[model samples]
Target: MQPANLLLLTIVCVLVAYGVGYARSRSLAMPLGGIRHLKSLPFYYGARAALWCGLPALFVLGLWVAFQGKVIQTLVIGSLPQEMIPGNEGEASLLLSKISNVASGALPPSFVEAPIVDASERLQALREQSRFYMSALVVSVAVLAGFLGWVRIRPKVNARVQVESILKWVFFACAALAILTTLGIIFSVAFETVRFFDKIPITEFIFGSQWSPQTAMRADQVASQGAFGMIPLFTGTLLISAIAMFVAVPVGLLSAIYLSEYANKKVRGVVKPLLEMLAGIPTVVYGFFAALTVAPFISDLAASIGIEASSQSALAAGGVMGIMIIPFVSSLSDDVINAVPQTLRDGSLALGATQSETMKKVIFPAALPGIMGGILLAVSRAIGETMIVVMAAGLAANLTANPLETVTTVTVQIVTLLTGDQEFDSAKTLAAFALGAMLFLSTLLLNVVALKIVRKYREQYD
Candidate 1:
């Protein structure tokens, strides 16, 4: 069946289940009056009933769907004539795929064998019928449970308090899910990084200068010795991030100040979204602009001054990345600046401080924590950015601070390491995970520090 049809069926089943529960509960509670009329809301009873009835059935449906193809293929193979099974595993797998397609009416030619075709037809029909019956049973049970719960409603139940407690638990569960997902990702990265460290000593990976990752194809072949040192990639990331911050922070902060303190309402309305429009531009577009236009322009400018410049320089990539991050910084800073009580700005103005003076001394100081938070967010964006650096910075990992030279970033290295034909267990491939772990940890640390600063400042204001 099509994905859309499956989705529609599932939704219809859930709604039917909810309706049944609602009706059953109403029927049971008809005789009850006053406080005894309801211990909980009718909707709450329906929801609880639906959860119990639908969750298990849906889980079963999901598991069955996942395993059904494999089970069917195994059964079909066992029943097939031994000679019909292809000699090679790959060929056998292909034949099985063709058989499945034929059964599903996706193949042009109909199968010639009567028994095989009949069995395939019967199996498909059975699966569909089973699913339909399961859905109906699940919905019926849900409604029955909801009706029973509704009949049990009474004045003494304190349903409001119960509902509030249930909501708190639900929120807690959602938070746990988010935290667990993060932890799972971290652990997966850590495991692969550990494997990488096993093959190349941690010291070599960390301190080596060159980064040629090519390995010998054969025992007799001369191998271009791989340099696992990560210093160059790390340095490139830092350099680019620094350039981006330099450009974005000042421009974003100044624009935010103008918007919050000086701009007329009409200007604010037109300019804020226009500034935000920069964020919506795709990174690929920025990459081309950096590579084709900005880098060439910089090289020409440098040549005029008698300094050699790379056609693809770090300066071009970093500068464009900075421009990309400006809106993120400005929009966030604007919100935090505006959030600083207007009364504070007014109070500073009333003391005869000029607008600029008030902004620098009073409003800016008051909003410093928030501004820092925005800067930290921008830093994270700069570090994680991939496309601009990959296109304009070139893939040579150079450990240099000179923006005029080409430098590759951690993200670029990670991309190059895992692309094309790759063995997941190899050190080169696993190195990508190590880089990911480091990136995740660094961003997490920055976010934590920013949050603490913001919280402390918030407490002081309160």
Candidate 2:
């Protein structure tokens, strides 16, 4: 059976187990006079039966799905003739791809070697056998476990305790999985970054002014020597992010203040949704808007004022990005401001403070932590944005602070470097990981700064 079909079947079994368990518990309870005589309720018994019927079967299914491909590939590779075996990981991967294509009927049978055809047949047979065994075992285990759970249900058995214990471990496993995934990403990026640093000097990467990532494939080739300087990329990223923040912070904050403190229910209802609609617009649409409208207007306006501006300037990208992130800051700030204790507002009013004065002293301070958090999130969003920048700001890694000059960000360069089919062993490809590591560190620093800001100003309410 297909995994999806098996999953559906397992769910049906679990539901049937729940019904059976519930009925059996009630039957036992009636013999004992009433459900009050049982140690726990019928709901607990049903839930326990369902958990038994589902959890073990699901665990086995997950393990099988996770490891089946690797096991099959290992077996297939081992079965290959000694001369037919690949010498390297890359070649092995290619051979496996071909085998998979042939097995799936994508490749013509007449075009391949006889050994490959045989291997493809073996792969298909093994897969069918594996699926057959998996389905039978999973179904048998589910039925047996369900029966055992139902039989074990007694007046003295504590089903609630067992179910809660299992759920607690499941939650812990989920949390651990997330942590492990993050660690895996960090380690993978770090390894590639180290490789990148080995190819290019650390000093050159960090302090060099130019940003060219093109490396010559051969020593005789007259291609760019590929300056791995990150300064230009960092400069462009910060310049655009600063422009975005300049446009976003004050406007978003003020709008939030108005909405929370002065705007009536009707006004807030109409204005807030309209403002948030900016967020719903796709970044690609914003990219088109930036490229088609904003960039040209800025260039024309700059030319009219006799101030030179690039047709694709950081101002266009940053301004549109600012508009994109405004709802993020406004919505989060509005929520935090409204969440401030009503008792504190009333106390300030009783002290003859004006509404504005109350907001300045009491509510804003209370909400400042969450506001800072929102702003940090917006800044991160601005930094990570690529589509708008790619369309509006040209991807020349120019080391200038001028928003009117065309420039590119670290993220843009990372995307450019990894855009095509390229070997990972190249410094050019590894540079993407190096850039990613830097971006990750920049975000981490922002989080640290936000925490410090919150700690310095956080208010406590009893």
Candidate 3:
């Protein structure tokens, strides 16, 4: 049976076990006087039975599914003659691909040698055998464990403790999985970044100004020189991000203030959704708008004013990105502003302060932490944006602060470097991971500053 089908059958068996255990628990109670005669509730007994029926079978199924293909591939490869064995993991992977393609009939068996055809046949047979055994084993284990649980359900048994303990461990496992996934990402990137730094000096990457990364792939061929400097990329990132924040912060914060404090319910209902709808529009759509509309307009306006501006400039991308992230700032700020105590506003007004004065002196201070959080989120969005930057800001890593000139961001460069098949050992390709590590550190630093600001003001407000 297919794994998905097996999973559904396991769920059905767990439900059946729950029903049986619940019925048996109620029957035991009826002979004594009521449910109060039992040490634990019938619901607990049913949950315990469901856990027993589901957990072991699910564990076995997961383990088998994770490793079955590799195990089968190993067996098939081992069966091949000595001359046909792969010398390396890459060769083994390529051979497996050929075998799979032939087995699936995408590739004709006549094109490959006899050994590969034999391996493919063996692979097919082993897969069939594995599935048959897996289905039987899972069903048997679920049934046996469930029967044991149902038989052990006595009036004096504390099934609730067992059930609770199992659930607690399940929740802990879920939390650990999330943490481990994040650490896995960090370590994977960090290892490649270390390899990158081995080929390129840390000082040159961090401090050098030129940004060319083209390198000759072979000794016989002439190619452009490669440089690994990240200064220009970071400068472009900061320039565009600063411009976006300048545009987003005032407009979004004011919109939030008006929505939360000044607008009536009817006006808020109509305008708020329209405002937040900006966030719902796909970023690709914004990219098209920025590239086709905003960039052209900005260039024309600059030319008319006797100023030089590229058709693709940082200003165009930053402005459109600010418009895109408006909802993030406005919606979060509005919620926190509304969350401020009404009595505080009233107390300030009772002392003869105007609405604006109360907002500035009382309510705004109280909501400053959350407002900072929203702005921080908007800043992160601006820094991480790739679509608008690629579409509006042209892909030239010019080390210039002028918003009118064309520039490119780290994300755009990372996407460019990693877009196609490339050798990972090349400094050009490994540079992407190094850039990713730098970006991670930059954001981590941003978060730390924001947190410090939040704590300082939060303590005062509290």
| Every model's TM-score | 0.77, 0.88, 0.86
Superposed Cα RMSD, model 3: 3.4
Local accuracy of candidate 1 as per-residue lDDT tens digits, 1-462? 433455455556566656665565565567675324766666665555454445554555566566766776666666677767666655656666666666788764454565456546655765676567555654455445444545544444544565567668768978997999888987889988898888888888778776767785666543354667878888999999999899999999999999988999999999999999999999999999999999999999999999999998889999999999999999999998888887888898899999889989988888898888879978999999999998888998887989999999999989999886466766778888878877888889989988888887763554
Query: What's the lDDT for all of these models?
Result: 0.77, 0.91, 0.91
Report the lDDT tens digits of candidate 3 across residue range 1-462: 999999999999999999999999999999999999999999999999999999999999999999998899999999999998988765787788889988999989999999999988998899999999999999999999999989999999999999999999999989999999999999999999999999999998999887877785666543354777899999999999998888888999999999999999999999999999998999999999999999999999999999999999999999999898888889989988988888899899999999999999989989999789778867877889999999999899999999999999999999999875566777988999999999998888778877877777763323
List clashing residue pairs in candidate 1: 21-143, 24-147, 25-147, 35-155, 39-153, 39-154
Higher-lDDT candidate among 1 and 3? 3
Candidate 2, residues 1-462: lDDT per residue as tens digits?
A: 888999999999999999999988889899889999988899999999999999999988888889989999988888889999988765787788889889999999898988888899999999998899999989999999999989988977887898899889989999999999999999999999999999888998899898878876677653357778899999999999989988999889999999999999999999999999998999999999999999999999999999999999999999999999899989989988988889999999999999999999989988989899889878988999999999999899999988999999999999999885566767888899999999999988887887788777777677
Which ten residues in a row are the worst by lDDT in model 3? 216-225
Off by over 4 Å in 2: 1-5, 75-86, 90-133, 217-225
The TM-score that candidate 1 achieves is 0.77
Ranking 1 against 2 by TM-score, winner: 2
